[model samples]
Structures are given as C-alpha cells and as structure tokens.
Target: MDSGVELKKFGLPSQCCECGPQKSPALCSAIFATSICPNCFGMSVTPGTRYHTLLNTNEPPDESELTFVRSVASTVDASLEYLDHEIANLPENVKRLEEKRASLLSYRVRNNAILSPLRRIPPELLREIFSWTMPSLEGTAEVALCIEQTPWMLTQISRRWRVVTFSTPSLWSQIFIDYRHSHINRDPSTYSPSLMKAQLDCAQKLKIHFYGSQGIDLRPQIDMFKLLSQHSSRWEELSVELTAEMVPILMTLRDRIPSLRRLWIQWSTVEDQTGVHSIDCFQTASSLVDVGIFNDYRFVPVLLPVHQLTRYDMDCQLEEHIRILKQTPNIIEARIDIAFDEEVGSDSLETVDLLGLRRLYISPAGVLKYFKVPALEELALDIYGEDILSLVRSLLDRSSCSL
Candidate 1:
C-alpha cells in the first residue's frame, strides 16, 4: 500500500507528545491503538524505505515494514508511561523548598533580635536621645508637622523605646497644632482626639501653639479649643490664631486659665471687629505676665491684671499703645507697632512714665518723644519722620535715661 495515502487515512496524534506525562500517556496510548502506530505518533519517525520508494515508483509496502512499526510503538509508549509518574511528584518538591525558606527567615529574625545593640541602652539615656530629636520652633509649620512624627516614630522603633518616649513628659509638653500643615485635607477629628488625650496624659504642663488658616472648617478648630479649655489649669504658655467664629470658644476659658503665663493671640480676619474687642479669657490669670497681641486692637482693654505684666508686645494704633503703656507701668520690655489713624493726631498727648521699662521697641521714631521711659536702656525704633533726632533727644531729656 502507498505509505503517504495510508498515513493520511490514519491521521496524526490528537495530543502533543511534549504534554506533561499524566495526560500524555492516555493520549499516546489511544493514538497507538489507532491505525497510526505508537512509534510514528510518539517519535514522529519517517516511514520505511518501501514507503519512500512507493511515492516515486508506486510500489506497495510489504508486511515486514508494518511489523517493525508496531514493535517501535510499544517501546515508546512504555517510556512515556514511566516518565508521567515522575512528573506528578514536582509539586511536592516545590512545596518542601518553600517551607524550608520560611523557616530560615524566621530563625534569622530571632537571632538578629537577640543581638541588637539598641536594646542594651538604658531607658533613661534613650529618653534623653529622643528629646534631642525634637524639631526647633524656628519654622512654625515644620515644627507642627514634626510634632506628631517625633513621639510616634520613637515609639515604633521598639517596645522599650515606646515606654521611654511615653514616659518623658517634656517631649509632649510643647505641642504645635497647625491646621494648615499636616491635616489640611483630613477631618481634624481623625487625629485630634487621640493625639490630644495622649499628650495630655503624658504632660503636666502644656505650651500649646495653634496656627490657623483661612477656609478650614470651623467645627474642628472650635472642638480643639473646647478640649483645651477643659484643661486650662495646665496651660503654661499658649499662642493661638483665631478666626471670628472661633473667638467665642477661646472666651469660654475666661477666669479658668489660672496657670496661663505667656499668651499670644492673633486674629485671622477683621470682619467681626466687635467680637474680640474685649477678650477677658485670662482676666483672672494671676500668673499671666508676658503678652503678645497681633491684629486685634481691642485685646488690650479686656486683659486683666495688666499691671503685673513684665513683657508686652502689640500692633495697634498710637493712642492704644499709649493707653496700654499707661496701665502696664511694671512692664520691663515692650514692643509696640504704631498704626497712625486719624484719631492719633499730633495734638499734645499726656506723658506716661514707664518707670521700670528697660527695653523699648517702637515704630515711627517720632512717637518716642511722646513716651517718658526713665530707666529705658535698650531702644530699637523704626527710624522714620523728619525730626527723629529731635524726638530721641527730647525723649532722653524727658526721661533722663542714658541711651
């Protein structure tokens, strides 16, 4: 018979020989049982010479050629059957290697933990080192963002470090709360409550600096103020910028802040001129001394016990500064920015003697002539106006203070 024509009639194997051994055997066996013998199907061998010659000469293949093909098919099928059994065990080998790797990693971690030098440092010294990591107050925004990071990062370093960082009250005492810096987009409630409680728990005395920004939600700011007010007795030094809506929240701390000493308040907006015109929050704060008021002209009238202040800083109209100086005779140092309004005329104003004042920083050099600082030693004036020298000479003459 013609081999080419017979091969076409028998057809090729249904599955590839390269397939994994499990599927290959059944497919190979079925192909071998068919008219195509196993040898031709598995090895894909060329047919005998008679089959090759038949293409050119039209000769038929003898029975011997058919017998040889049958024998080869049987041997090839046996080899495939054995190989399929070996391939099935590969998954188990892979799993064993993975388990070995995991065990090694676990051992390495345990060994490294035992040898870590950081664990050897004493708790006291470690706390001191953590204290040094605190950011300085040069940049308010940067300091505010880093506040949450300093104590948090130290605690995460190790269990021992966590204990040390939490125990150190000074690390948490100076808190910088900037609504614009870190929590610009997040709701303040997310981090405020837990952070405030944690700080309060760790610190005995708090120096809180709250920096506000425009367009932020008022609720969070008000909430923070309310929370802080609850612990007003622990407030040692507080510097906060308030919007019109948040002004009332601050006023709630009136007569309650007995421990307040240094106070700094700034108004973010001027729309509600009458709202904070009289801030009596620290009216009963006997410990209050150093005071800095920015952008709020009405702040001076409401501050109680101004006579006890040792340092004062304010940006207000000329007459208001004079009014404040008249009340604060005990002030040792004063920084005043004079805004010349129509009400502040060159008409002779009363001479207020600051008998105890040592340092005076006043804007508009001419305004110095109006003050009588008898003990003033250090003077920094924003030198302007035509008769600055005459003003200085006149002030020195009136006070008899050596410049």
Candidate 2:
C-alpha cells in the first residue's frame, strides 16, 4: 500500500522504529524526511493499522518479529471470545425489552378508558346517534327480525347505556316482524311471544310492520299479531301482510287505530295467489295520509280516507287508478302500475288534474294522458327508447307544468 493512503486509512502516523508511539504524525514525518533510510518509515514499536502496511511493505517478516506476530494473534482470539459471549446474551435482552413494550401499551389502553370520548358523550345524545343507525319501520324498507341487533345490542353495552335505551320510548316503538323468523325444527323460539311482549311493553306510539305468508302454520306470527294488536291504540303506522285469520283480528281494531297515519296492506291466499279481500280495516284511521296497496295480480279495493292522502302507490287498472285519483286530488306522489286487458286510448281516458302532485312514477308511459300533473317535478316512466321523447314531450306540454 502507498504510505499516503495508509496514513488516511488509520488516521495515525507512519512511524519509524526510532520515533516512538507518543510522537505526533508531523514529528514522525519530519523525522522520516530527514532520516538516512526512507525504507524504514512504516516500522512501529506498537501494532496499528500502519503495522499491517509495514509487514506488506517489503518481503516476508524476519525471524526477529515472530514473537510480536504471535502476540497480535492472541489479542485477536481474546477479542473474538468476548464478542461471542455478548452475542449469547442477546435473546434474553430482546425478551426483556419486548415485555416492557407490551406492558406500556396495555397501560396506555387502561388509562385511556377514563378519558375516552365515548365516556364524555351524554346518554341522551348517544340515544339520538343510535336512532340514525337503526332502520325506520314506517317506510317500505325491510328490516331484519333479529333481537340481538340495534336497540337490543345497544342495551348490552353497559348498565348506563341499557338504562338509557330502555328509557327512550321511541327506540322501542318501531318494530318489523316476519313469519319466517320462526322455524319449527331449527329455531322455534326465534319469534317467541315473550320477546314481542317485552318489546311492546316498552314501546309508546308504535309503527308496526307484520309480514306473514300463507299455509305455513303461522301460529307464532298469529300470536305475535294478537299481542301487537292489543296495543292498537298506540299504533301510528301499520304495514300488514299476514294470513291465518289476521283479517278478523285486525277488524276488531278498525276505529281503535286512531293514531295511525300510514298504511301498507297486501292480502295473501293459498299457493301465493293474491286473494281478494275488501280491506277497509284501516279506513276509520283519522290521521292516515300515506297508503300503498299491492294489486299487481289481483286488485283488492281498499277503502281509505282518500281525500286526505298525500301519497298513493297502487298497482291497478287505468280506470281504477283514475277513480282513486279523483278522490285523492291532494296526492303529492303517485306510483301506479296500471294492469289491463286493453290499453285505454288517450281520447277516452278521463284527465284528472292533480295540482299538488310533485312526483309521478307510472309504468308503460302510454298512460301519461290520464293525469294532468301541473306541479310535477320528478317523472319516472317505464318505456322503450323510441317512444320516450314523444311521450315525455306530450306529458310536459299537456300538463302545462315546469318539469
């Protein structure tokens, strides 16, 4: 190796035998520059990085340096032994550090519980937040018949939350129960009356949705319907689709549902065939405003306080819908799928003016001429591509409304 390169690598003086270890690099350089032999520059009294350079500077080491070579070899062996001993303790050291880290993490979680943001929220405010998460029973949206969810789940949080949910009457007032929740062999207790009884007892003004099919031995559902019907005075809305003498049972509560406002009724019969039942069970409901009757296959004429209705969604013939719209001039939204043996010609169909109607969803767009919706804002028509432009233009122009 070159002397200058060796000097930078070790940060040490390129010493001679005469110039000792205590001498500075500058002193050594000056001593070497003035020395008689420039070849003896790298020889040092003690071992350093320059010592290796000294050994490789010329030929092999002389016999006089054998003892010094053995001393350096022994020093390297002792250093290796010390490092290996330290490496053996590494696993124990890592285990202790990991234990400390885990303990500190758990301590932080425990301490955070006292000042958690959930703890800061009041019980009434939490109840309000929960109401938005739960489904609204008044609408047509289907809700699952699970007791281990929502308001029930909220009560399981803690004692304070349980008391809060139990005290909130609105949380328990709305329920949607289906007959399929019960299985004779698998889980018969799924739709037990005891659960409904507890739910009804906690509820105030109720919005109940009861759905049951035909020929399923809907004994549990019937029992539940009987339980819910007892609280008919508290009813604010009823979406009924059940069988097994549900009609006569509901008939007893004709005038009793005074607080009822909205109704969705669908009659069920043998083998899923739409049964004909003249349902006026909810007719005397004084506060009723919204109504929907499923009449796609068979139209069961529902006698409602039609003049006060704000919304009507019925699947009936054109003539029948026109007859209903005549009674419901105040209807704001209408979704009518007209069933027919023959389409009614625009000239012969009666034009009913619904000045208050804002949204109209009609199937087969050909029936647009029957209603003159002057205040129409949203029109949903089901038709093919070619007939769209003409039908829509005619409806908009004839209605004389900005849609």
Candidate 3:
C-alpha cells in the first residue's frame, strides 16, 4: 500500500453525523469512533488481508458502508443532546457562585469593623498621642510647617479628635513668625487673624519668636508686633530679630510685658555710633530675669533690668560687656562673647564682683581677669588668645574659690 494513502486515511472527516455530509466527500466512519456514521462503521474492516485488499481497489463498498454510516449518525446525535442539556444550565450555576462570593466578602468586612483595635483606646490617651505629633517650637521653618501638620491633621481625623485637639492648649502655645526671604513678599493682610486669635485664646502662656530678613520693610513687622503686643501680659518668652527701624515698635512694649521672663533681641548689622538709642522699655519688666543681646554694635545700648537678671548672654565689645555685668550684680550665670574691634584697658577698668555667679562662659580668656566671681563653681574658657592658662590661673587665685 502507498504510504500517502495510509496517511490520508488518518485525517479527520470534513463532515460529521450531526451535520451530515459537507461539500467534501464523507470520511470512512470505520477508523474514527467519535461523530462516525453508522453505515461507515459497519463497512470498516479489521487490520488484516481484508483491509489491505479494500485499500487496493478504487471502487466503493456496497450496502455494508451505508448501514455503518446510519448507525454512527444515531449514536452521535444522542451524545450531542446530552452535552447541550448540561451547557444550557451553566448560567444558573455561575449566578449561584457569584452570590456566595459577595456574601463571604460582606461578612469579612463586618467582622473586621467589629474587631478594630483603635476603638478600644481611651480618649485621653488618644489625645496625648496626637499631641506628640506636634513639632518642637524651636526652629523657624519647622514651627511654620507644624501649624498645618499636627493640629490641622488631627482635626480632620474625626469630630471627637478635633474637639480634643482644640481643647489641648499646649499644642498652640508656641508661635514662631518668620518673614525671611519669600515669606516677606506675602501681603500682610493675608495673615490669619482668626487663627492667631484662636492660639492666643487657648494658650495660658505664649512663647513668641519673630524673625525678619535684611532689606524687608518694617511695616509688616510693626503690624504683627501691634497684634502680639495686645496680649503682652500673657507672653512668657519673646525672641525678636528686627532691623533698626523696628526697634522703636519693640520699645513700645517695655512696661506692657509684665509676664515676660526671658527676652532675646538682635538688631540689623548697621552700626549705631551715637549710643543714644536704647531699649529702655524693658526697664519696667519686673518679671524679666533672663536677657540675651546680639549684634550690639549695630544698635544704641539696650537698657535691661540688670539688677534683677539671674542669667545674661551678651555679644558685644569688652566695654559694653563690662558695663552690663557691673549693673547685673545678682547674675548667677553669664555667657559673654567679646568683639575684637576694641581692646580692654584692664588698668583703667574696675573689677566686677559677681557674688552670686555659679557658672561663667567667656571667650578671649583675657576678659576673665576683669571679673571677681568668688562663688563661681563652673567655668568654660574659649582658649582663643595667648596666656589663656595664665589668665585662668589668675582668675582661680583671685576668686579664692575651688575649681
């Protein structure tokens, strides 16, 4: 037998029993079990001499081929009917599965809501956790970002959280106002009066920091100062860095800051040679016990309540440093950074006796020989000049105090 003829016999029929014969001739149903005609199946011969002899002839088989094809047609029809019935029920089966999946998901969500751990935390403890989110009111930029981050974020979480955050006064007590760089370009009217009032209303004691950049107009700063000055009695600490033009506005608060305990001020770099402009307003601040002055050469001398001050930090010339110390006889701690422009004539200067001084930090150790701190227990000298060791030894011997 030809190999091509054997290979052709293995090919699938162009037509099957379910659809009857197609335009192409029907395949012999004897070799294939699936979709075979009954007549073709009866005509199929066993793999022997009979099958080989049938392949050799070109003529078709007689009644046996017709009977086999008819029989196969009946069997295929019955099988297709069973498959159609199963396929017809698939939509109902799919609908039931989708419903079960939805039910399971809903039940899981309900169970999770009932078991949520956050609902178990007490209100007081929750408020304390929110409080910790507030940034420390030290640096200028950090404090500005904190206003929008902590209190605002907490209020947005829930109604109860908003009430708790607003009731907590300490969160709003520290206020930092910086008008440096781009911040100075904003319109003064845009500053929120309501927000400022809310902070003032809630806080018992306020710590205010107001900083200004060079070349910025003092008009906006003066307006801000006016608003803050209204509540000066509540200010516990005030730090202001302003231009020389803004000093007069600050001096307006001298007698008004009755509750102020600490004050820090820095003037613009422009030198004040007349020595006539002084911050005499703070002279009446009875509660003012600590004072810090920076860039003193740029401003007229600042007049502080020196006799009542327990701590003083002065960045000034040696003459001004001596002048402030001589007035502050009750100072217990002092940090002095002397400017190098002027030399101190020790022979012409009188010795300042700081009887209550316990801690002293001084740069250009040559200044130590000018002070008589008998009660000094802690001393830090910035060893910048020659004879620092000798100066310290002389200070130790003159005070007659143990190191």
Top candidate (TM-score): 2
lDDT of 3: 0.71
Of the candidates numbered 2 and 3, which has the greater TM-score value?
2
Q: Tell how far residue 63 is off in model 1, in angstroms.
A: 57
Return the TM-score for each candidate structure: 0.66, 0.69, 0.68
TM-score of 1: 0.66
Rank by TM-score, highest first: 2, 3, 1
Q: Count clashing residue pairs per candidate.
A: 1, 0, 14
Over the full model, what C-alpha lDDT does candidate 1 score relative to the true structure?
0.72
Could you tell me which 10 consecutive residues in candidate 3 have the lowest summed lDDT?
Answer: 23-32
Superior candidate under lDDT, 1 versus 3: 1
Ranking by lDDT: 2, 1, 3
Q: On residues 122-214, what C-alpha lDDT tens digit does candidate 3 reach at each position? A: 878987887788777545454562336666678787677787878887766777777664654564443466667767787778888887655
Candidate 3 shows a clash count of 14
Error of 3 at 323 (Å): 3.4
TM-score of 2: 0.69
